[model samples]
Target: MSESAASYKQLKEEFVSGLSGGPVGEIVAVTAVLPIAALVWCLLQKRHAFFKPYTALGNVVDYLLNVGAALLAITLYANSAVLLMVLLLVPALFVLGVPPSTGARRKKPKLPPAAKSYNSNDSKDDTGSSSSSRDFDVLSTKPFLTFFRGSMMVLTCLSILAVDFRIFPRRFAKVETWGTSLMDVGVGAFVYSAGLVAARPVLKERAAHAGGRRAMAATLPRRLAQACRHSLPLLVLGVVRLLSVKGLDYAEHVTEYGVHWNFFFTLALLPPFVAIFQSALKIIPSYAALALILGVTYQVVLESTDLKAYILTAPRVDLFSRNREGICSFVGYLAIFLAGQDTGMYVLPRKINPRSGSSNATQRTTLLMTMAIWCSIWSALYFLTTDYKYGAGLSVSRRLANLPYILAVAALGSLQLFTYCLIETLCFPEFYSAADPKAEKEAYNVATSRVLRAYNRNGLAIFLLANVLTGLVNMTVPTLDASPLASMAILVAYSAVLTGVAVTLDAFDMNIKLS
Candidate 1:
């Protein structure tokens, strides 16, 4: 047979193969075990040391990471190989802090001579204030670290993996070829990434060890302004999305099925609103309460209305569902995203330190217990919901924020993460060194450098390039092809090619944007 015929036959064979649910489950199980094992081993090795103080830090990071990860999940909904890879890759940024080198170049940790003299003079009465301010400054540097390490690592792994397989859900039987979920993920990623940057100053203020709260407070408005401004690129993307609905004939293309045209429009409206909310949070101290109220209200709407049906299946409209039905109606979800962002801005701290404790072992044990309970609850819910068929019929009363669902999802995630930690610990007890975390980094630097170099040099450019690449890929292929194996293969190929191109361009410091 000719080469073309052979290629077609191979594609046919690939399409015929099904994803073995067992393997998928095992992968999930292993990923969960890695982190859990890591946590345990760390505790065991450091059992002689004190650990309580670090617990808060871990908790804070975990919370932020989860929110960030959830933002990543929006990509999964789109079921795009490109989108999923991006989603999985970007969160690594939040997990790992900025590279050590970036921090070194930014500034010298020095006090102004006048301030030093004033500090010396005031030390007798207000040393505490000065110390507090210093701590805040230290914390502000974390975002850069996280952005560099986590984002690079995650993206590298995801890009490589995309060449191996596509990861997605088995449900959504007749869902579009690609996931409309990318819209959410794209919006969420920008929001979450930018939010982390904005959070740095606020958290720094809280962590400050030397500057008095007054000094920090005085600088906050300016800091907030800078953060908002830095986030403008993402916000602009959102605006483009919103306006696309009006000017772009998004529907003319067959590839547009999974494209939720208005998701970004909704996202475009979040930052400014969040900025306003954050300002209020300074005065009210009720951001959490407000978030709770709004979340609950949104849930109530989901539960009581035919909103979901209308949003998921209906034809297009100007403002509402783009024209489908579901509680995820653009207008409604936008409201939720705005509310969530505000809550996160005002209530979520930038860095969380663990509580000081006398024993590391004890804290580890506590975390493990928490994981066990969370897992139990999640397992229970998964089984219970196995029988609940999701219908297009709108049950206006089933809020997506229903207590059970929220609790279950969180628990499942925690359990999964803990399990992964545990497995990693079992596999390699040492922090990254045991498995040479930098192995990939070095390899990425060498072979993959051409495409990734620019991204490595500057994150913003890489992000734009990545999105454009993803969009182009999405336009080129069927986004929602449901056969798991076939989808996975296609995505893997797509990811591989993109990564190769990205790496090649990065190595050369060629800044290119696919968009």
Candidate 2:
């Protein structure tokens, strides 16, 4: 083969094979280290009861330990990490236990008269008004969930890039498997979800301002404008990144982003489009329909023509044909973003009161059921569309973000959310209350563990930090030459440094946001 062809072949082989596969191991290690380190730090601070169950710190420790234990089981016995993670929830729930409830005879807490603004004017009764207000409040208040979302994004980024350096098992990297890898599906879903969550405040504010018949009409233009503003910086960053890779002569995965299609570009562009559609239509169902239609269309086109090969091997890169995967996948990802917005609507309600039947147990049970149903329905859809016997099912192509890929992401993301909710509900029920800001802050500090809160507080900063460090590490270390144990150690140490930096910054109240 010619030098250029030989280079392409080498890159392809490198992408396909590397270290052993270990999605569960990487996830478990990353998740477990921070909380465990925090506990150790707490011990050093002379907090003797940090590991005791029922206390805030103890509850976090319990959850982390359970996660660790479950991961160990998956490593030793189970072939499916997703299934094992779900099954582990049973023991987690049992260990954490349910919140204590007020008896049926106890009267529900009275809402302040002024707080009634959360309710709709059309509410028929006090109970209806209270319910409406509470839901809205919960939607607006949950900082911890936002933090968790950011942290998940950071984790997904680290895992993927780590695999690039052979720091983690190569098998966990993106593959054309029947079911999707967690890391592969996670990164795109998290980015899209973050965009949706970030746009919620803007969406809600716009809707409120345009309350009359023109509400729908007025909101669309404003949201589109807002999305344009959001995308501008990302677009610039994407351009800078594209130029940097080309200029620096870094190893380029052509199919991953194509020549001009950076992730920053996708982030900059897709959310606004999704937001516009959402502003004009019913959010979840509409977007879900779009995803199905687009996915099917893409698949049919792929099978019928040489489009896939052309996209993969096209010589010239430009605004259109060569980057078709990146351009086309935006539709599917927007659908994912819309689905995330629907979830945010559900999980971030205005309030939750044990006395009003919107207790932690109720919420957790609801999320759990939703997760189960979605997973089952999506899995069935996958089997229906593609044959599993010959590994012919929908592959988790980040480039395609096809129907099965979307379903897998939605299901897995839901499972993650459910797990987090369960942990919060059982371990720190007091943190769920929207009424008392002081108490909520205290509960958040305890529930998340100080280190986690730090990471949460400076999520974007931590992500940037990881990227910079990753570059430095690649320059300094022979990553591909390292043993698995050395790679694991390096990853752990890298994560620890990130956690420390985040904690220190959060201590000084240095959390930064571009907008």
| Best by the TM-score measure | 2
The TM-score measured for candidate 2 stands at: 0.71
Best by lDDT: 2
Overall lDDT per candidate, in order of appearance:
0.36, 0.54
Candidate 1, residues 155-204, lDDT tens digits: the string is 43333223222344322111122121212222333333333344544555
**RMSDs, each prediction?**
13.0, 8.2
lDDT for 500 (candidate 2): 60
Give, for candidate 2, the lowest lDDT window spanning 10 residues.
Answer: 104-113
TM-score of 1: 0.47
Q: Give candidate 2 regions above 4 Å deviation.
A: 1-151, 176-179, 206-218, 279-287, 300-306, 313-319, 351-368, 387-393
Which 10-residue window of candidate 1 scores lowest in summed lDDT?
Answer: 108-117
